[model samples]
Target: MSAALSVINLAVLARRLHDTSLLPALTPVSVGTLVYPAPTSTVEINPNWEVLYWNTSVYGVVDNSVILECGTTLPDLYIWSFTQPGTEAIKAVVYNLGRGPKIQKIAKTLGQLTIVLKSADVSIEKLLLAANGLFTCQAFYNIDEDPKVHYYYVHLTVRVPVSKPNLLMTGTPVEGSKLWMHCSVDNGTGPIKYIWKHETQNENITNLNESNSVIYVDDVKRNYTGWYHCVVSNAVNTESSDKVWLDIKFGPDDPQIDVSPKTTSEWGYTILETQNVSLLCQAMSNPPSQYLWFYNNFQINIGPKLTITRILRNGTGNYSCSAQNSYLNTSSSRTISLTVYFGPDNPQIDVSSNTVMDRIYTAVEPENGYVALETQGVSLLCQAQSNPPGHFIWFFNNSQVHTGSQLTIPKIHRNQSGNYTCSAQNTYLNSSSSRTIHLTVYCECHLQQY
Candidate 1:
């Protein structure tokens, strides 16, 4: 064997010779003498040759093709081997030798040369993540004692596009339960990033910045109920998962009551007798809240609101509301007192004897009007029926006598008795009513003779 080498690319010359028949179907091969020292590194290969290596990197996604080159002119013998990721096992996949395993199942010899290397091409067609590994192409030229070999290897990294992620939940989310959301894909190449999304009825969509496939939320609440999904992305592609509804069962909080026809007085909320009023109750709950209304501790209505078409003075009392959550079997309540203001009716005089504590008599009015004896203590009182009792004024014989509901005289004389008038005034209605009593005074001397 001679150690002579040719500078022309023998692979191109071989193609031209094979096409024109300038020579026999035999190919012209390059024979070269060794120059570089043997690589101190040893790779896994059966029947190993001097591994002077030149490595190039290639990246390809799933369903795409990557071309690998020998990087040398035509040699007498070339061997291609495959090494799986994270393994020491080497398999002769495609080679000129007839004794090794075949990569013809997923590979083909490409006719186009590489742009930079100007070398022969072999393509791994339709790459898969399963095919991630190292590919070595060794070219050999036999020259007497020192055999020359060139190793052209490619580090092939395969990436698969992320599939539509499938979102899953740990269980039915309930109040105080820990919630776990998982984004899973049947086929995806990692470093895949996952993002969790929350869709709520009252707010905008929220992105839970969770980078893992699974994320957990401690202590779920009723407000945490919403639609959830996941967005998964890789170097290959980005995809989103189908939506999953997260419903949390919680409680009916304390009820609140709102009254219509807003009016207030010194005695709290007030309304006129003929006014219409409404009481609306509400609470925050899951599965909605059931409402019950009560008046003065007696259940009077159901539902969220109680309406009175024409309320009277009798409609004034304590109004209570209870909100209940059927799922949780919990309830809450609140109460309010409603007051309806009415009138001050016709005033009358009621007489009580303060003259004797042991012997007391009350009379609204006598058939003969009022009579009093001279030198006897007498009290004249006025009364009226009204929501808030009324202010009073007293007049005697067309003259102002007093300014209160009671006019008491310790001693009376012959002329001390006359027409006594009491007037009751309602400040709210701006109305007044009056009643006058006729009184006759007698001499104390006649009573002493009796």
Candidate 2:
């Protein structure tokens, strides 16, 4: 028989023997025994073999202990004869439900019989069934004998389990700022699914389905600054890591200036003598900054404000200051002008006081009514007045006669002088004048009193 027909026949026999109930009218009764039917096979194997069977057609009837004969007629078989009377051996062949045929045997002799199969072309189920069943033997003659075949089958199943997920963070969090996290597993075969959770009061969070293990938080708040982790899972298992913290940083604001000697006037001024002037520059900032002073366009080498001691005329000019920090720089102030005053110097005069005389005559002849006589010096006095007076000069006959303002004659002689002129001058002004006089000298009258 073929392997396919044997398997089909076995299956039919099992269903009829195990599944069919004989009495359909039987009902359950109180205080009576119950009957249960046996289970039918979903699959089966057939052709049970017995231990004492042999090919009667191929070998002459020896006793039950006879070994099968080998001849030119059975080219594929080997037979060995034994002396023991009751010993017997049988070999059975079966076909695999999946591949080829297999042989199995049982021996009842003290001696051994080795049966070698042509090839290992049989399925595992067929070999197992042949080994499990009782042995039987049959004989076939001629090349047309139906090929002996048997059949067998098998079934398989599998199982899997659920797991917990885990998450990881890639970078640190910025203070009061956003954070980013990544999800992964310790040991799993995966394309894992990722999820994120915030353990806040609201428990508001989201799930992302991407192959990448990172998640981002935008526009983070103070409350959002908390323990954060991730969940990574697959069809097989899931896991999570420990929570992490985050931190963020910020900065300072702009600055301003305030002038001491509180003056609301856009420009500040002070009446300083030959003394030092101090200016205070103040501003608002996170950290105090350095102060720089500027005069006109040039930067001042001094402190926040420029100080000039014995402030002279040159020390006065435009002034300004600047304040600077790491973040920002700013300038504030106005230009100021200074003035100085003084007194006048000593004064002087150019004038003189001296004696000088001239003579004048009415006529040159003595008969002219007593001969009136007039006399004058050659030069006259010239005087000038001042706090510290200057020098003066006198002129006679339209010529300078004295280095000073005055000219003098000892006696009024007849030939003493003619015209006298003088001039006075100083830093303030100048003046000039001229005078004429005549003089007479008479001898003692010698008439002898006649």
Candidate 3:
């Protein structure tokens, strides 16, 4: 048993010495009963040697498998080796036997290196930061060939996830103002892509492929205000930064006034006396607005709205609304006119008499008599007191005659002497008052002038 074990150990030692790191010359070896020409000059090399190059950079993460490329395309015998950074020792890992369809490794094809040269690639598994190094793939022809050896190299770097990033802002955050935001991280692998995230108007998260860490907004609006942050990622892992609040401060726009229970007419607003009135002021501001109400240029109320119960005639005037934002120190104002309708009060009727002393005047009365000379002009006027001007209607003997505040007769005749009534009406209030006057025309005829 001891003699057989010694023979097995000697055979393994011979195999190790044959596949050493140094390039070996073509030689002969005997196996059992057959003699084999070891590695001969019969191996041919293709001249397309310039096609292979070194892969200078490759990134990988810990505990992950990384494929390191050996960019050789020639089908010659190959040997795979590795050299750690800051080291001069070259460790042989795998080699292809010159014999047909034979691949051999220094150890079994399992742990550190699995040479898959069918694709000219070496896969390193269960990697560590210490596994980062330079890998070499060497192609060799037979000993008699010119330039018996060529080598291709690749660098492998094990990466770690990026640390927590930091965000920055430039310029003021206000409406219509330009703003810029930046994101940065201290540690991460290169070729890193940055992603920006923000809370939108509806409070939903959105992602942006902003290319760089900097984000630019040309014209900021109110909707741009929200929570903002950044994420940095590579092939390995991704990490997010702390969130930042971006609040935009804006202006108090022009104020608007709305009055309830107010009707609009051809003249203006018509409001009834002893009615409920509500004035609501509206304006857009960043911090909200404080409302101030003005009547006839006098400040009367402070709030967003004003309510007056049992409104009277004194409530009629030019009303103004102003909104102010205390933080922005800005204000906006709007003005409007309110007309309160009340009349028609007592109506007055005045009639002309030939003699001024006997002129008949009546106020809200039934009737009065006026004596006027025939063939002469006479004028009658109607008057009333009201918030809005009252319309006057004249009737003769209770029949509608004319629609005017005044009535004039071009020629006073006997037939025109009758009861004339002047009625005053406030169209908005639907109230009316009237007065009547009767005119009597007489003829003072003498000798004819022909």
Index of the highest-lDDT prediction: 3
**Each candidate's root-mean-square deviation in Å?**
9.5, 30.5, 11.6
As for lDDT, the candidate ahead, 2 or 3, is: 3
lDDT of 2 by residue, 269-327 (tens): 53233545555555433235556666676887544454555654344455565556544
Could you tell me every candidate's TM-score relative to the true structure? 0.74, 0.22, 0.63
Per-residue lDDT tens digits of candidate 3, residues 1-450?
Answer: 122322342234335444332322334333333232233333333353222333356777766778776554544555566555655445556555455333334323323556564655677677666666655565544433332454466566788667788999998888899999989888777767888998976789988757797898899998778999998888777888899999988878998788898687765566888888888999988889989999999999999888889889888888888999898798999987777878887888876644322444656323356667778788888999877789999999899988999888878787887788999998857889998776766666521221
| CA-lDDT, candidates in order | 0.69, 0.36, 0.69
**Candidates sorted on TM-score, descending:** 1, 3, 2
Candidate 3 overall lDDT versus native: 0.69
**Residue 122: error of model 1 in Å?**
1.7
Q: After superposition, how far is residue 228 of candidate 3 from its true place, in Å?
A: 1.7
The regions of model 1 sitting more than 4 angstroms off are: 1-52, 72-77, 86-89, 96-119, 140-149, 265-267, 352-368, 373-376, 428-430, 442-450
**Each model's number of backbone clashes?**
0, 51, 0
lDDT of residue 406 for candidate 1: 88
Best by TM-score: 1
